[model samples]
Target: MSTEKCVVCKGGGTIELLGAQCPFCNGTGEYTKTGESYLKSHICQCIFLDRKTCPLCGKKCHHDTPNKPKILIGPV
Candidate 1:
């Protein structure tokens, strides 16, 4: 279950969540997690290619970000 091609609606899947709104960080999302400041300027995956907003919960989207493997000690 790993697909690719989305880079900001470039794949035509869908992308557009309040575009063109930067104005010196007026979006008020968040950043400065450390040096170089994180957030990458108000997310730029175009907007969220498609719409489900799940890119591993990283912020942007484009596929390749779904990895949920946690068993710890399972046996069922």
Candidate 2:
């Protein structure tokens, strides 16, 4: 997947210039590992804005699984 530059951190992954993690990306200018993909270094929560994406697979679905915040990544 191609990651676009973060609108907030602009791909720098930090804001305020204090080394503080960007609230939107948690320091990952693109996306952060969240929900069931916590062990992963990256998550598609940001990539999947509709929130219907499968955590185990990158398939978009219509299931009603409540979004859990294992580590909330930003929305694309």
Candidate 3:
């Protein structure tokens, strides 16, 4: 199932999901279409950085990426 896009992060904005090493693609900047959809396109490395703070270090973190990739279904 695809995740419901939030109002702010609906249009390919990785601001809501940013991290150093992206979990989904592991910073490869690529993804697969197997059992995926456009709506769930945001399911990537950024998703792992969803938390506002670092759970391990307990430091304040920011999840904003100016160079966010265009999250679409079929291709990059």
Best by lDDT: 2
lDDT of each: 0.32, 0.49, 0.35
Candidate 1 C-alpha lDDT tens digits along 12-62: 333334344332233332221331242222332323444334332244233
Off by over 4 Å in 2: 31-76
In candidate 1, stretches whose alpha carbon ends up further than 4 angstroms from where it belongs are 1-17, 27-36, 39-47, 50-64, 67-76
Candidate achieving higher TM-score, 1 or 3 = 3
Best-to-worst TM-score order = 2, 3, 1
Give the CA lDDT, 0 to 100, for residue 38 in model 1.
26
TM-score of 3: 0.22
What tens digits encode model 2's per-residue C-alpha lDDT throughout 1-76? 4476555556677755345777766677775443224423333442344455634334444333365423343344
Task: Estimate, for each residue in 1-76, the C-alpha lDDT of model 3 and write its tens digit.
Answer: 2354322223233323342443333333344242134333323344255444433222343323453442333433
Model 3 lDDT-worst window of ten: 6-15
TM-score of each candidate?
0.18, 0.34, 0.22
Pick by TM-score: 1 or 2, better one: 2
> Where in model 3 is the C-alpha error above 4 Å?
1-16, 34-76
RMSD of 3: 14.7
